[model samples]
Target chain A: MVGIVVVSHSERAAEGISEIAAEMAGDTRIEPVGGDGQGGIGTVPDAIEAAIDAAAGGDEGGDAGDLDPVVVLVDLGSAVMNADVAVELSDAEATIADAPVLEGAVNAAVAATDPSATVESVREQAEAARDVDKL
Target chain B: MTEDGAAAVAAVAAVAERIEAERDHLTELDSAIGDADHGGNMARGWAAAAEAARDLDDPDTGTVAKTVGKTLMSEVGGASGPLFGGSLVFAAAELDGGVDAETAVAFAETYLEKVEDRGDARVGDQTMVDALTPAVHTFKKSIETDDLPPIEALAKAVDAAERGVAFTVPIRARKGRASYLGWRSVGHQDPGATSTLFILEELLAVAADRLGVDAPETDATSPTIPDEDPDEGASEDD
Candidate 1:
């Protein structure tokens, strides 16, 4: 199973979205990081990096070893920029999904929760949401 | 600390002070064309950068530069964080040990290139590039043609940057949040360009201090006190 990291400019938005996605997350790790540290509306690269660490289970002295690849989903503008920079700095195997944050996270949660889901499969399902009809 | 390294820190500290003082003004400018956070973001970023520079443990100039970049990237939010922060990181990669006239010229040139590549902005985009491009070109030209002392060359660069900032007032933005305004973005100075000019002015001040010459005070901006010579066992601020 792949892990999911949700990045939004608003801290509450990221956490709320993570919570929604978690309903379908099963055993997969889903972490949320957002907002400038000062309670402002902006994303922080350091926060994103920390979320990636938690998703990959790297904070407990070492990798939990059972962790899967992590995927990041970002909202507009600097969220994407900061996330890209964070991923580069972390030197991790994480990839940012190009899908919409809410829709992608929901689809990704379901895909990643499956025991057979690989990082690629999770990303595919997440991205495929773009074509899903929503009446 | 080497002479050049100490001078570099002084330059960044000067920028931090200037940004802090002008923060509200910068925000006012941004409010007209973009999000009003540019001022706050730059102020916080420079504060972190100044702290990093002050606390450097006699490291090489390159390490100091890298630390500044990393700190800004981590501390600053919004588009300027990555663009300005990435520029410093790239410049640090280009810099070696002690700073010299040629190395400073190289830093400006490389910084300009990195910003262009990262932002995909041009000279007329009403972005930071509008100011930085001219300043860098002026710096490089002064170094190549007249082989002027570092202070004089940097003065020209600062002058060019100021002119660039002024030129942004009437141009419609083509990039960043300001671009969303289309023609409405005209008639206001770009916050990024103004800040870029401030940074160049501080750099020129550093050059003048290093050469022990009084920089020409063409504008009302106050001059910064030069750091004590490295032999003086660091300044009180250190």
Candidate 2:
């Protein structure tokens, strides 16, 4: 029931990762929220807040309890800053983790869909990706 | 913390602090070939995640992962946010309320597959995949060997990740923002790779701390935030 929101400079990239995660997860409830960094617009706190809200099922007027914890994924600098502020301002319970944009996105998406997923597990997966020699 | 949740919550807290400490260096690396906001982005994401985790009176691993993942996805913008966010989500799923060598291995494998499918990049693509793929494989191998405990397995994985990041120095980038630079992307360490290394280093530090092997040195330079009484923020907005 954990919801995942993938924020990126490009909407396509977020959508791409979300699609794959949905495919892998099957019936699990994984929600993908895409924020287009459109011409630098994505870095705005308001935009990021909207994205998180949408991802949390807030946009549809779902009850907060029905709303699972929201996980926000982002791409670049100000976007990170703005997203941070946005989460602080919003009423929804949320958390953020660092993920390398290129590799961690898919892992995060898949992780978001699991019923028993936790922040520690997701961070471990992200950290584990740092090892290249084992691959 | 629940029996299965303690390790993960501790892990998230440890890594968030480490990432905050390393934020500037990450941005500097990104500045060389890409948008130059990697550190800022990662820092912002972790700060949000940390804050979210802190807000919980008593949090389970699932709650912590979802909170962190959502913050990263919403707060950080760029390719990194979603990618890193996805990794956490996948790891959480694999844990399934349990933390063990088998679950850890499963988390790694799931992470690798997600990266490949989403990024449209492979092992040799000169992306973070270079670091991630090797770490996952090594973790799996270590689990099979049974020669090391989870901490040791993580340590080995961290070493492999660093090596993988180093390998990116010579390869021409064939994916992500760096790909446009072609040969120019060589020589300079990939920002994604460098951050990936930091993530592993933080994880290892946390594991060691939990296992009582060695405690992480406190950061003397960080400005301390005075804790606001929880009573002041207890009102539910809804």
RMSD of each: 9.5, 17.9
Fraction of native contacts, model 2? 0.10
Q: DockQ for every model, please.
A: 0.45, 0.07
Q: How well is each residue in B179-202 modelled by candidate 1, as lDDT tens digits? A: 899998889899999998888877
Deviation in angstroms for B97 in model 2?
3.4
How well docked is model 1, in DockQ terms?
0.45
**Chain A TM-score relative to the true structure, per candidate:** 0.92, 0.72
Name the docking class for model 1: acceptable
lDDT of 2 by residue, B47-95 (tens): 8887877777676766677677767766666667656775566555776
Using DockQ as the measure, the top candidate is 1
Q: Please give the CA lDDT of all the candidate structures.
A: 0.83, 0.67
